[model samples]
Target: MSGLPPFAAPMPLDAAAPAALETTRKAPTSAWYALAVLIIATVLGSIDKVILTLLTEPIRQTLSLTDTQIGLLQGAGIVLFTGIATLPLGWLSDRYDRRVVLAACVVLWSAATAMRGTAMDYGVLFVASVGLGVGEAGLTPITNSMIPDLFPRAQRVLANAVFALSAIFGSALGALLGGTIVHLTDDLRPWLPVSMQQLEAWRLTFFVLAAAGIPVVLLVLSIRRTPRVGVPAAKPGAPAAVATGATTLRAHLREHWRTFAGLVIGVGLTSVGLSSLGTWLPIVTARTYGITPVQMGQGMGLAFLCGTVAGGLLGVGAMRYLQPRMGPAAALRLIMLCNFTAALLSTLLLFTRSANHNFMLLGLLVVPLIGSAVLLPNVLQDAAPAHLRARTIAMLTMASLPFGVVGPLVVGMLSDALKSVPNGLAVAIVATTLVGGALGAMVLRATEGPFVRLMRAAQPT
Candidate 1:
């Protein structure tokens, strides 16, 4: 707030002038440091979310949970609550300091994660999952809102990519770490306090992971506040007006509902494939290949790493090739391609006979999946008015909630239904991906022109 730059007034789309595609201003060292911290934070959040996936079999066996219950825990329990909390949290991010908001979120989710360790039944675990969902909901909107302010327009894609890559790393790290913890629980038990020594390996794993959030909270608080770029300055002696901003955003959405509808629904459909893959791939592989949890974790972890590296390179290359020709619409084009590619690759699972080969294919499939993740935030940030940025992101989350929630649950039900058939889980995954990809592609194709116009309209004259 101290280095307060002059804020720009909002102009109607028809009256706005086209601005240059790039800026000469370089982001400061502090911005890069902040990004580094953000990377760590993202990684921590992802680990918390993904650890459940790796531990699913053990948890199901321990709690006497059915596949449907596991699906609800993975899909609806977390995704549903997260969607419920996103709008209010997004409003808070817009109205208050993001660092404080994000820090509080970390604490809440970390505590919820710790609570998972103490669950003795499906009901208790479901409650913990709800808490975890609500806490983690703030992360996407707050982080997306912050990145635009932290770096100039030209550098945003790279910054967003870096942040997105952290998630991939976290997934990998979670697999490696979670698997190692589960594998070594027996040896680790002797070092624990007497009371904790009797706890299950999965429970102890949660406790250890929950403690990791403390440092992340401190790091979040350390981030310096950055000015909200493109926001109009409040009148000299008046409080910033939230009602006006909300009204303006609602009007904008109403006027361009088709574009937003396509974007929200398309992204949601795309998430179905990814969500199902993440939730069931490890468990299915373990069951089909007769591998230990640690082996599955290690293989999956390596796949995540390989995919992250490959995806980052591919994303960068695609952006460079496409942005010059199509500008903001390039992102949508890339995302559509990613969806189709992921769907096609998912079918290959039916043919896979070995664990290593299946994981290797999964790594390749991650390439486009990473591309979509990296660009989606940039798309929302670029298109939404600065004052409504967080809310717009939250809207996407809220709208897409059903897809994320239903995808895994449906896969679980399908797997259960096909239990008598060979490679039934693989068949279920393939079905989900095919439907999601085809529908997502059609919706996104309709959105491309509108998205481009909206991006241009949102730019400063």
Candidate 2:
């Protein structure tokens, strides 16, 4: 514990001196600022996602869209941009001011979210989604990288739990608000300055969400900079290469294999279920069960909030408690298993016959979605090295993008085939829960203790 191994005293990763990292500084017993930024950032991501999810049916009905089309608009389109945009942005954060990058990302994503409501055709919507995706991708690396620096060893689990809580709350806010906002905006258009177009309802929804991002972005602007931890000892004369601009696509790929691979299979599959439920469920209910958007969003959103928040709390708390008693791998593995089972419940919930039964199912399903949030971030952070952290997040993000497509596309296909949104959702959710969950679990299995150990060993100690 003598001030960052001999090598960590910050040489130069780029022209920027990098944030003057307090590697040697005692970790804060409490990391409220870090926690606050994460929650704010998660809110930004969640709002956009909720916008996409809630608007799916309205947009589809307005556009005369096919089921597959809805899937593309929500799932595949947004993720594609996110996957591509993250690597460079992530690397840049490693080199420059993360707060700056985060602020920019907020603006970009919010604008994109606002624009989405105005989209007239598939092309415009797709473009907007890509922008939104890329914007959303900006957070994971910087946020994850910041936590270790802020909390150190004693409070890692606590810090992570805080983040998980944000993820759950953010999603709930989006879902809970989406329906209400749409109702309000649609009704109030005549009094507002702008003309309400056919898609005006969704457009208004985006504007409101985008407008809310300002305070957080300003806060990001005001926050003091936190630096990356530790310097590379680097081999002999090879000289450490600090990531400046985005690393080459190939170099990024070389640095991230397992994380990306897991991301692809795991996130992709998760998207299959998540996208279906989050984006399409409202539409499915409205189209099939003859429910209103407000009713559907409120019900499902509440279940998600309850389940995810509970799951996240339990997941983080369990890891915190279990890590010492069991081991890191087992602790994490158990959390993941809980997540897998929760996803199964979410799937089952969507298909239940009785409304009460469906709600019960949804509540059960929230457990895993929430559990995964708690564990996945920590697991990925553990897998990657400081230098590769951003790149790793970006890669895994990219891998997850396709599943966004898969989930929606499958649902769309099923809808077209079955001629019913309910039937389509039932099939889509079930397939993704089983297929995606299995793949995610498979990826989790690959995380075996040693890989994580080496990754941790590589952290600035």
Candidate 3:
């Protein structure tokens, strides 16, 4: 309360760096407008990514896919491909006009979403998932790099929270929209032209969702270009340096390996649980309680909204209370606690007796799950230099890949192994969540000292 909130200030520039680097701020109106556009894109992208989660049952039945195959589609198919694309996209964001890169990403993912509607088999569907992953990969790095430049130090936390909440809100909106489309597909079918009506409800849902990207693309193009605030502009007519950005990035990584290691691995482990929860919670709820997808969608959507809002409030309160005492380390401690809480709540999902009970637990479960969404970016933006922000974020994403690939797949395999047991899928989800959360907590605990030290060193005098 007395000092700057954690991650509210930019990192100090390297001492060896040139003194000519000038920091420029965007106009408040332009900055807010860009954030609004980013929120829309984040929401639309999330809808496209997660609509498949809601349709898992129908897609499985149609394709004659096992739970394991569905797991691959949800996990490795999208996440592995995303991991492959993230670094290159991150590099591009650092070197080029991020607005153009972002606009192109919207188009690619939107097209990929439409392609999913035409999938006749798992192979085609898998390819579409890959496309979706590649397109969506640009979002994180670009936004992470861009947000700091848009707002000044005092407003950074507010801007970061708003951006993070957009993702949660987008996910909730996705579930609602997915549910509504599934519910209305039959009613809307009759109005379609003859050739179009033959597509299944799930197929048509993708087509409709993909159309939303058009406006998002236009919005991305409209964002005014902002200077990379901490980056030094080369003097006019100076010879271009031969050293690549990657070389400087590698040196920075070598210098700060401990902080990055803890962040990447700890967060990666936590993602395993979150990924499993996102992939299987809907399917498990439907199977356990015999609820329809429409019902599942509405319940889950409401749960996501209520839970994220509650979590956001709780997180802000906790940060305000803790930062004054513990400083920047408060964010890390909050994240660890959230993971533990999520693990405990996830285990309780196995015991819920009714659809409403299960949905209520899902809401409670998300309360803890939303912590990383806000805090992780806060930590990263504070730790990395402006020139290296996107790549630094991309490295975090890449580190999470192995864990993300394993999370859903392990749950599916476990579910298959436990198929004869009552609540087999729930049991699988519980096991993964407990392990991921416990390990993630321990890893993050180790990182606390390193992170605090890094933040102290980076603080502007």
Candidate 4:
């Protein structure tokens, strides 16, 4: 506890750090425009993930699938591949035009999502999900890597808050609009070819969401490319390896493993609660109230909308109130504070039988659960060398898989295991939240020294 496990500290990642651009300097017109596009695209990607959550019950009924199978499709089947895919994709983002990379991924995932409608059974659906996962894998790392280069450090929390908020809005839309689409598509089943008249509503919903991504792909294609600010412009004769940090990637990670470990593992643990809740909340709602999926969508969509706003304000407010006064280290501590509360509130969500009470607790859980999403990436961008930004973010993305992949899968297994219990899935969810929160806090506390050291190294001389 006195210090992090031995790892070299070196000058924190960006050795030839670009001059930090001031927000007041030059027109930030293009940066904001590009950010808007990124937000829209990410929303589409988020919808792709949450749509499964919205339709889990119907899919289970249609396919006669068990809760565990549904959970596997939503959790590990998607995120495990996402975790595996990020490494190569991160490398491409580091070396290529990220806008092009992003656009390509958007098209790939959109196509995969549309293909999901054609699945005849669980195996095909799972394979389609794996494709969706791979496509989405390219998004976060590329976007987070690009953000710091576009906005000044002073404004990064706000930028990240906006980014995080868009994901929330997208998930909310998935619930609100996805449910509505499912309801409306019931009429279209009649017009289907005789063989397909029995096609499920969820399949049509997937098609509608897939169509939404097409416009986003066009939007991404139009964004102007920006320079990679993490890497200094190469000297005229310098090798490409030097320009991209490939030669030093291993050495940098070797010495700075503690910094990366603390940030990645700590933040990743907190994601378990978020992942579990996202997958199970709809099922929980239906069981408790007997509400239709459309009604469930309305309640959840509005709650998520409120939670997004609250999360954004907390993330930005923490930076405004803390960073200027106490520095980036303090801002990092603010995330730890949120993590602690999330652990407490998430457990409470399972204790209540009242639908209203559970929803209120969920809103509270999200405030802190999402605060980490807005803050941790800023910390990663600050800690990693510019040339290695995408890979580092990708590393963080992969870290979340342990918990993100397991949380829902375990909840479903637990639900089935304890079916006779009054609220088995709810219990499993709360138990997972408690464990993830506690472990995250411990890592956050343990890694504080490493984080401070890294922040000090990143400071302007």
**Lowest summed-lDDT stretch of 10 residues in model 2?**
1-10
Candidate 1 displacement at residue 97 in angstroms: 1.2
Q: For each candidate in the order shown, give its overall lDDT on alpha carbons.
A: 0.81, 0.66, 0.82, 0.75
Q: What is the lDDT of candidate 3?
A: 0.82
Candidate 2: global Cα-lDDT? 0.66
Off by over 4 Å in 2: 1-31, 197-199, 232-271, 320-322, 346-351, 354-356, 420-422, 446-461
lDDT (10s digit) by residue, model 4, range 175-276: 788778888888778876787667778888788778887788889989876666435554443322334324356766777788778877876786676577
Q: 1-461, model 1: which lDDT tens digit per residue?
A: 01112122111112233434225456778888888888888888888988888888878889999878988998889999999899999998887878888999999999999999999999999999999999999988988888877876667767888888887888899888878978677688888899999888889889988999999999999998665665544555343345332436687678668879998888788778778987887878877777876887899899999998988888878888989998868888998888788887888888888999888987988888887777777677766766777888898789888998999999989988998988888899889978988888888998888877776665554
lDDT (tens digit, per residue) of candidate 3 on 1-461: 01112221133335454423323432378888988998889899999987998888888888888989888988888998898799999998888888998999999999999999999999999999999999999999999988887876667778989999889989998888888887787789999889989888999899888888898999999998766665644345332122233336777677778888998788778778878988898888777777777887889899999999998988888888999999979989998898788887787887788889888988898888786567878888877777778888898788778998999999999999999998899989988988988898899899999888888866754
Which pairs clash in model 4?
Answer: 13-385, 230-386
* Structure candidate 3, residue pairs in collision: none
Q: What does the lDDT read for residue 200 in candidate 3? A: 89
Residue 257 local lDDT, model 1: 81
Q: What are the RMSDs of all candidates, in order?
A: 4.3, 5.8, 4.4, 4.9
Residue 278 deviation, candidate 4, in Å? 2.0
Q: Give a tens-digit lDDT track for model 2, residues 99-217.
A: 78889999888888877867878888888888888888888877876776566544565677778777777777777887898899878877887545444576778888888778879
